[model samples]
Target: MADVVNSRSRSSSPSSLGATEFKFPEGLVAHRENLPAGRVTATTLDGTLTKAPLQLIEDLSNGCGGQLWPAGIRLAKYFISRYRNGDELTGKRVIELGSGGGVTGLAIGLELDQIGGDIDEGGCEFWMTDMQAMMELMEKNVSFNGLQERIRCGLLDWADPLPEFVARRPVDIVLAADCVYFEPAFPLLEKTLCDIAGPDTEVLFCFKKRRRADMRFIKSIRKRFVMTEIKDEIYARESIYL
Candidate 1:
C-alpha cells in the first residue's frame, strides 16, 4: 500500500549512536549473478536453524522467473523466524506461488529438516509451484538443497485452472513473493488466489511496491480477503524501495 515514501531529515541527538549496521533479514542469504545463467550458494542462515547452505541455479534464458528477488528472501527469512517456534508448519499444507528461484520454499524445507520437524505425510506438505517455464529451475533448486523428497516442484499457471495437486487437497497456507510485477498477470493471480484460498486458508504474500498498478492488485485482494500489514524492521525499511 506504500507507493510514496516520505523523505525526512532530522538532527540526531548525541545519544543516538545505537544504530546498527543494515543487513538482510535473518535466516536469509542469497548469492545472485548478473549473467544469463549461474549458480547461487548461501552457506549460513541464522545459525543452527539452518543445517546446510541453500544453492539455487538461475537460468534467465527461461524468463524473469529464473532469478532471485528481494521479496522472496524476506519471505523466507520471516517465515523461518516464525517457524522456529516449533508450532508453525506442523502438518500444514503450504504452496508457494510464482516461485522463481524457489528460495522461500527451499529454505522452509531446509529449516524444517534441520530442526527435525515433520515433513512426511501427516506432517508439513510443501509445494513450490510456478509457470511451465520455471519448472526446471524450481526442480534444480529443490535438488540442490537435498529437499527433493520434502518439496514438490509443480507447474502452476496463474491463468489456468487449479492443478490436481492443489485441487485434490485443501491448501492451508499460500506463500507468494514478487508476484505482482506484471500488469497483465494481475487478474490471473487474483483468480488463482481466490480459487485456492478458502475462508480457512492463510496467504502470506510479499511484494515490492513498483507502480500504481500494484496498488490495484492489493485493493482487489482486499475485496476477498482481510489483508493486514505486518510491521517489522525489514518491512519498514524495504517498503520505500522502488
Candidate 2:
C-alpha cells in the first residue's frame, strides 16, 4: 500500500469561522461569496489533456456557487503531484470519502488518463462519494471536467451502512481531505474505513490539523491504524496505513 501524507496551513482570513457553528441538516452558514479562480489540469479517458477553472466552494442550495476553500485547492494539487510522480493509484480502483468539491478524486482520475492508464479501457473505476448535497456538486464537477464516464458519483454517509456499495468490489485505496470535524462522526468514519479497508488497501486523510477537537479525533484513529507523517509543516496532513 502507498503511504498517504499531508501538509497543513492556517487560513489567513476568518472564512472558516462560520463552518464550525453550522450543522448539515440545519444548513451551512452564509459567509463570503467570492470564488477564487484557478486552473486545474485534468486528463480524459482518451488520453487527451485539458484544463478547467476551479472554484473553492460549490453551494448545493443555491446552484453550486460559493467561495472555494484554500485547503481544498492545496489538497487537490497534492493529489495531482502524487499521481504524476508514479503513485500506485494511477489505475487502481479508488474511492474518495467526503469529496467536498470532488477535486481530490477528480485529480486522481485525470492523472490516471494522462499517465496512459487503463480506466478508459474498462480496467478500473473511480468512485467519488459524499453527502447527498455534496454529491450533487461532485457530479457537476466531474461533468465540468469532462470526466463523466471515468468518474461515478454517489452518496456515502460514513455514519450509515454501505453494504451494497462495498459488495460491488474491494477498493484499492480510499481518500479523504479536510473531513475530520464533528466529534461524533469520528467513530463512524473509523467503522466505515474498517468496512472497506483490507490488508492491501491504502487510505489517505488530509486535514488542517487545527482545533483540539480535530487533534483528539486524529489521535484516536491513530490507535487503530498506522499513522505516518508525510509532511508535518504548516498543513499537517498524514497518511494512514491499514
Candidate 3:
C-alpha cells in the first residue's frame, strides 16, 4: 500500500484545524464516530480482532460510491470459516483484488494468525488492491487491526497491466469479491486474472446472482477457469478455482 500518514499529534494545540487522533499501538486507526454501529471483527494474520468504529466514504470521483456489499462480507466470512483449519493458503502469499472494504483480505490474514500461523512473525505477506479511494480505506482497515507489517495496500486497476505496478511475485492465491458487476470491465477482469494467475495459483471470486449480465460474464470466464461453488447463500455465489 502507498504510505501516507495523516495524523494529529497530542502535543498539538486543540485549536489546530484537524480532527482528534486515535492511534493503535499495533498500527491500526479507528475513529469511533465514523464507523457503523454494530459488532465488526476482522480476521488478520494473527487472529480475529474487533474493528474500531470509523466512517468510510467511497470516492465518487473514482466511480465508487463507497457502498459495502453484504454478499462480499458473507463470502469473506465463508473463506475464513472454510480455511480456518485447512491447509489451503496457509503461510502463502495472497492478494485480494478490487477490495472495496477489504473484508476478505483482512479476514484471511486474521484467520491465519488465529490458527498460529507465522504471518504475524513475518512469515507471510498480504497485498490488498483497489482504486485509489478504496485503497485508502483498505490501508486504514489494515492499520486499524494493527497488521501493518503483514498487510500491504495498493491501487490496482484491472484495466491496466499487472507487471507495470506489482512486482513479479509468485502469488499463491488471488481473491475477488463483488468486482464483476460491470459488463465492460469483465474482459479486463479476465485479462488481469490471466496475467497474474499461474497454473498452481488458486483464485476465489464472490458475486451476487442478481444480475443476468453477471451470470453471462461468469459463464464466459468458466470456459477458462475451473469454477466450483463453495457457498450458495441467498443472493451470492462463492466459487473456488480449479
Candidate 4:
C-alpha cells in the first residue's frame, strides 16, 4: 500500500510574535511554527474576502496540539479553493477532529454562513472537537468568529467513546490536520477514525511529514480505510514537503 504523504511549500519566518498574544502575520506568510499564546487572523479559504480572525491560546506548556501547525493552513486553503459557498457542504454533516484552535472548522462555518441558509434548507452544521484541555481555546475561536449557532465545540478524546451528540447521526466529512504524531496515540486515532467514518464518509487530512514514526500511524489506518492525496494546482508549486 502507498504510504499517505501530503506536503505544502513552506514560507519565510513571517515576523515572529512575542510570547504572548499576537495576530497572524499578514501577507503571503502562511506558515508559522510553535508560536506561544496568540490570536491569529487568516482567510477562510483562497481567493475570497472572507477572513476568520481566530483567538488562539497556545500553551507550549501543554502537550501535542497546543500550537497551530502549517498543515492546518494548507487544509484551510484547500477548503477555500475547493468548497466555494455551501454548494459542496450544503446538507452535509461536517466535523473537525482534533481541532486545535478551531481554524479549519471555523473557516468552513464562515464560508457556509456566507453562502447563507438555515440547516433545514441545505445549510451545513459543524462540530469542532479536541481533548478537554483544548476546549477553552476552541470555544473562544468559535465565539470569536460569531459561529456559535453554526458550529458546536465539544470534548472528543480519541481514546474515549464518541459523544452521543456526535454519533447520533452519520458524519459526511472529517477534517484533521497535523494530528498524526506521537506514536502512542496511533491506535487511538485509528480506532476513532474507524468508529466515526462510514464506508461513504470522506476524511480529509492535511499534514506535512514529520518523522518516520508517522508512517507507522498511517500503516495502522490503512487496514481500515483507503488514504489518498489531493493535489491542488493553486498550491502545487508552493507546497513544502515534510
- Measured by TM-score, the strongest candidate is 1
Among all windows of 10 consecutive residues in model 3, the one with the lowest summed lDDT is: 1-10
- Ranking of all predicted structures according to lDDT, beginning with the best and ending with the worst: 1, 4, 3, 2
Q: For each candidate, what TM-score against the reference?
A: 0.80, 0.67, 0.67, 0.75
Predicted candidate 1: what Cα RMSD to the true structure? 10.8
**lDDT at position 167, candidate 1:** 93
Model 4 segments more than 4 A misplaced = 1-57, 114-119, 232-242
lDDT of 2 by residue, 51-147 (tens): 4333123443532322233344455556566666444554567777887666566656665554323554645567788776566667766766567
Q: Can you give the lDDT of residue 15 in candidate 3?
A: 26
Per-candidate alpha-carbon RMSD to the true structure: 10.8, 10.7, 9.2, 8.0
Q: Is candidate 2 or candidate 4 better by TM-score?
A: 4
lDDT of 3 by residue, 38-154 (tens): 223322222232232222222223344133444445556666667656565556667778887566666556545532235445355568898766666567666655556767787
Candidate 3 vs. true structure, TM-score = 0.67
Model 4 CA lDDT for position 10:
25
Estimate candidate 2's RMSD in Å.
10.7
Candidate 1: which stretches are off by over 4 Å? 1-34, 43-49, 114-121, 240-242
For lDDT, the strongest prediction is 1
lDDT of 2 at 37: 30
Q: Rate the local accuracy (lDDT) of all candidates.
A: 0.70, 0.55, 0.56, 0.64
